[model samples]
Target chain A: MEMSAHNCRLVFVVLAVSGCAPPDSTSEEQLRPVVPGGFDSVPVPVHNPLTRNKVLLGQQLFFDPILSLDSTVSCATCHRPDAFFADGKAVSRGVGGRPGTRNTPSLLNIAYHQLFFWDGGSITLEHQVFGPLQNPAEMALDLASVLQRLESIPTYREAFEELFDEAPSLRGLTQALGAYQRTLLSGGARYDRYKAGDQTALSPAETRGYKLFKGKAGCLHCHHGFLLTSLRFENNGIAISKEDSGRARVTGLKEDYGKFKVPSLRNVAQTAPYMHNGGMATLSEVIDHYDQGGREVRGKSPLIQPLGLKEEEQADLEAFLHALTDTTVLAGIEGP
Target chain B: MNYRNNIFIAVNLMVLFLVGCDAATSDTGSTTLTLNLNAQVNGKPLSTDPGTTFDVNGTLISFESVRMYISEITLINSNGDPVSILGDGLTVPAKNEDDEDISHTVQDHIVLVKQDAGIDSYDLGTWPAGKYEKIHFKIGIAGTNNRIDPSQVPAGHPLAKQTDYNNHWNWNAGYLYLRIDGKVDTDGDAVPDDEWAVHLGTERFLRQVMVTHDLILEADQPGILDLSIDYGEFLRNVDLSDPDQRICHTMNNLPVANAVANQISSAFSISTDRKRTGGSTSADG
Candidate 1:
């Protein structure tokens, strides 16, 4: 069934507000999938159904700096909600100002993804929680230490006991964090409206840009479908310098050297700079790079060719991309 | 309900189901339409060899590579109704060297064809077996299909593979609609002065070409529709001597792309009995 753009936006706003309430026995109905247009039912692991209490506890832990070794940085430090759950930096800085190799991908609609990170090393959202918590450049705290710290806090201890009927455990912590992230959905963009059969949702330039995007521009070859990402790895010539091995670092295959996981374009306007390295500063720069074709490098995907877009056409394409922004998702609403 | 009423309802339902089946079967007969692509320069088959030079407005040029994408195929029925042949919006790429038929099926209605590939034919899906005249197709990919990421295409699809034939610019998020790289001697000297690369793309570069031809399709039999693109005619309108149109490797050079795209629309036509029909479309560029 099709939904009007306005109705879709209203539905998402209601879902977002209602999902933010504290968990209770009657909150079980809230856990039902609230998928928007062009999306299927959100895959929820049976072992960990979304609950208000779990999401609230996870939200608290995410903002709390106690997860770090020095207790000075929180998950919010890198995945800032205001920044669309991505720190506005080329590469995110971890605890003690240590830098990472790749850019911090936005967490908007991350629950819909089957893999995580630019390399896609993490298989599940629960598994991904350990990477930042234990990475030397990130939280730099072991699970045992994190649990001990949480157990020492009277409030955290009571909360954990009340929620899990036990003390803070590694499983509970990751599940709670994953639960909160699963609720971080980005929908109601103008693009969504346009897809909902609202012809006037986009300007003429954006409409032309959308046509170009599907036609001559060829962005849909990879970034297609509802989430706007294939979620696969490819070498788009961004690794020409060989400074980073990308996915090869994990797989150790020569052919996989420059390949990196394709990222979703949801909330892309808010999450920048773009690319795995965050090299391109603006959408124009990114468009220019593709217009000139990518850097001629070994293992560059054959798809990289010069686009020859006119200045006005480039502007139109940029405007179309801007229309993808969902202001509702950018509000940074925190639950009580 | 009474048994008599229930029996009567059952008979009506069976009759309605039979009629629905008959309606579906009437449109079930299908035939494939094969589109053949060939190139020529001054009545000779266009060669990729650097030694083969063709004079264009007093300039000697030899093409090192030539490639393009064709999409939005439509067959005009006898009644003049345009029948879209793209089912499920999938694209069938040109035949590769391994004789592998690589087709990338996306959510868009178009197809990719490489010029260097040997006599490639795209077997568009089955249609109602009949006679069709006037085939219409665009010279490049168009619409939302243009911005798809090649990586998302199936791994073995030509566009998804890591090769130059795909001719996609990932950074620019577009496809190279047409790429003609060659060496040109502008000074009328024996040796080539500079390398000329005419790479055209972007939404503005999209050109639509319609060719009038007689295509007869029989049940389960493939119908052949041959199209010839004259490389010489493709450069007929463009002044190669002009520096502004001499080399275009980026989107900044729209004038050159416009000139070439205009020529391309006029250059393509249906080849019948070794003779060609002049079929062209006006370029909006």
Candidate 2:
């Protein structure tokens, strides 16, 4: 069933309030970790409720190369937790050294995303898993083959039975991965601390840069909220031709040509190179590109305008972006 | 029963119910109607090369983008019974002066056409096996659906977000019924000198095109209808040489929009040779 943004949000709230699942001995109340101020409640789907066993299983699956057809590449190969869930490459390299067209987006705080992928093709995290796993350049494994491979493994079969009380299935696999990804949240950034009533959390330069970002730069229009992105697609004037239709490919709309989703600013320092295509290698370059008000392309968002920021102002803005990195989210992935 | 067991039973029941619904729908033997859309400049397929300028009237022009919204499709049977090709039933809150509910059904009513994406086809959904005479559809969204704040619509709806439809003008709170962005070369130098953007939307810009044809559908067999939209015809009357007519990005310019809408209304034709015993229509608009 297709859901509107409002209705989708309502569904999340309703499911969350109703506890997603009935109370049981194994279904312990998993309290959501405290988020930064201004962050909305973490939206959870009804079918995939969070549980300790499922999360652990998912983390293992995410790091295990066995999901790949050749057993050489894994989800972690591109989305390493150390690199803020984004591979430090212009575009992601998959199995057999094949390169993808778009960059691997940071998975931090992805549970709050209304849409998946830069193109917004997949509507749910569970649905998004099949795209990479089956893509020839990525894991290069079909769903049936992947499931059969997992079922063949004694450890995975035993774990699936223990957690879901069933044999390994496609639904359980995707759900577990989705649940673990939801826990990859970021809220311990200095910016988050500053927002939570700690005045000294940000340096004076960083604070000044925040003011410019909200005021002169007008980045707040699209990159507002606690997660820092409105999660809507926009033509930031990246493409010069019709080669990559971006969000237009998904919606089949002409006005969406060269448009891509506005990514979150959390842990912005670590996830580089930036942009959908990873054209900009540094945050300073990204800021410069935005300052010039994007390229001269059709369907460019009207909100993007030349800021004409001074050299010092540019450095200050870069400093503010650096302050958004949250190392605590990375700490959880160290052992597992 | 234990909570896990109860949950498992509920899931099994839901799956069973869904399977039953699918079986029932497939048992009806409903014929599928596919709408095929193709774009052409003059007699040739539309090209994306900015350097490939076409002679429209006395001026040379190149299109950077040609996109529009097509909705509210209705097929008139031989008996004159009008069948509305409904899209998914998702209500969008109106964003115009008069607030209204803009409804969409899950029957593939809205489509976006791009030159680079090649030919586009939409599965309009199943219909009773019969012969259709006339195909009616709007060039832009109808007034009811045109005025809604796109952001308020469900994410699944075509016009849910400005980015989703790419046809909406947030400032106007209305859909851009048609958008053709390109450049016009007045000096005949093969290089575009001035930008030409025609954005048509608002309540007044909505238009419907009716093509008279013999569309036949047989039981267990589908019908095919081929349609084409000629860009040359779309710009035939619009004077690109005149600066006043060169650029229009808002509803305030109704004359330009009306001219394009009139051209769109007449751009559709039923390819009699392409007709077959299938439930699909191949047409360009």
Candidate 3:
């Protein structure tokens, strides 16, 4: 069924029940989360209400290249589901075959992000949806064109009717994408299961990697949340020159030079060719880069101290990061 | 419709129930005030250049294209407190324009209809539902302007109507927030191209400025207390005289905007006109 009809139906059901209250508000099961401790049931922005139809529409939009200036790219062109919501490309290329300057970061657990982009300039998921669309070198279409294009599609118009009676718009696009993004979560990794008391899940190499990840390797200080990222800006030291001052460009602060968002590492094993500018081509190289005290840059974060690890520790950390991948979720979804 | 799928019906029912519970009432004698923001330059009312330059700064520097929102208004009382007017919000210099300012030309810049017609100060919850002392306001924009979701920015709003010249930052970036573009002696002579544009407002600086000045209205007194902004005083306060302080100079000094922003921000006082206020233009008063 179309989304608006579905929502109208759900709204009717909820409203009828809303007046009488639920069967049992204080039930232990009611208090328990539907998806474990995940899902802040309130969900996305209230203004951008989440609905199934819009989310489905957004999924179609994410895969549809009609959003680009030329019909060559869509959001999924970079955020493919099989590759942990990241394209395997060293640096994502946009229309007219132009290569982007920075690497396409992974989208796992992206819904929880407070800011988008390497520097965290885009503040909300809804607002961030248009970043690539407006970029001159990216999708290359201004928002007006994007809106006008969406409004022209019959499928999009039908989707809009199902999702909202009002036709296609940036808000619908953003909210749809955001709702789908919120669903792209990873809470059942081997480590997560291990932490949840199923210790029998990891092999010896994976176990060793878990220890190194927390201890001598010094990886957890920044990559610390349950999602495995402190989610702050740091000059991860990939920037060779001051010309592309990542976070500093947005904030104009001298200290924030080259600092990019510390992306969540939920599906780290699948998102290769890391860092903001995609300078390193492998995870082994990323560990080595960090081991060298982040290439000795002047604005480098002091926390990136050298970790003189033996080969076994590096391998263990890699195995541990790989342990974070939940192949079940990875294989089920096609694209965000 | 399936009874299970109709959320709007239930919500409508609740709204109806609430209205039935009580017929809400409010009493505030209202007065509508129209504001004509004559974009001026050097203490004179503004005039346009034929698509080359605008009122103050011409092609020497023009916001060829733009989109932005402004909101959050405040009115200062006779003493020193502020009353707020919410949602007097809008996105200015609308997206499309037919290449003309309606006021100056008989041919019509249809975009003129899209001009930011300011706030309707007579709305409820603004001033008490009665006569006031005086009305005072600022001319810039509020800080919380651009926080609006792009969808909420009113694409079809009357303000969004008009055909504009290609990429004219004029409407989107906000009222020449800092029009520093004239000439620089960086090497020697005053070269107009040597200008830098400092268009502030991070989707947060509301296109509209905060205003706090006393309004003079009473059941017993005058018609209304309307405070006037002296553009002359604003320009004089900035170092337009010094080569370095000139915001309109080729080098484009933005510190002047920051400085001017700092000066008139919270320090605005009510005025009867350019020549008078409550009692004093006296240096001490």
State which candidate has the highest lDDT. 2
Q: Is candidate 1 or candidate 2 better by DockQ?
A: 2
- List each model's interface RMSD: 17.5, 13.0, 11.2
The residue ranges of model 2 lying beyond 4 angstroms of the native Cα positions read A1-34, A162-166, A240-242, B1-285
lDDT tens readout by residue for model 1, B1-285 = 699999999999999877645321224466776767668876678887767788876778887767777777777766677777544644423212222223334643455666665546765666776556667777766745554434334333434422344365432345677878778877877555678877777677788887776666667877676777777776776677777677875454567777788877777766644433233322221
Per-residue lDDT over A1-336 for candidate 2, one digit per residue giving the tens place of the 0 to 100 score: 111112211111111223344333345454353434577767655456677667667777888777788888889788876677788999888889888888899988898985678887655676567668877778887656787889999989998777666777665687789877886767788998899889999999999999998998888999988889988889887754445678776555679778888999988888889898889999999999999998888999998889999999999999999899886665544332
Ranking of predictions according to DockQ: 3, 2, 1
lDDT of candidate 1 over A219-290, digit per residue (tens): 787888888988778888774445676766544467877888888877777788989988989988888887
For model 1, what is the error of residue A264's alpha carbon versus the real structure, in angstroms, after optimal superposition?
Answer: 1.3
Report lDDT per candidate.
0.69, 0.70, 0.52
Q: After best superposition, candidate 3 residue B15: deviation in angstroms?
A: 39
Full-model lDDT, candidate 2: 0.70
TM-score of chain A as modeled in candidate 2: 0.90
lDDT of 2 at B161: 44
Q: Per-residue CA lDDT of candidate 3, range B1-285, in tens?
A: 687669878999999777644212113233333232333334343323312323232212222222222223344444344445443444321111222111110111111111222321222222433323333333333222222233333344322312231111211222322222332223332333344232333222223334433234332222333333333333345433344654431113346555544433332333334422243321111
> Residue-wise lDDT of candidate 2 within B1-285, one digit each (tens)?
699999999999999877645321233355777777666777667776877778777788888777777787777876677876555565432323322122333344676554444546756666666667778888777745654444334343556443212455532345677878789997767788789988877656677888777676655776555777778777777899888888876444557766777787766655434544343443334
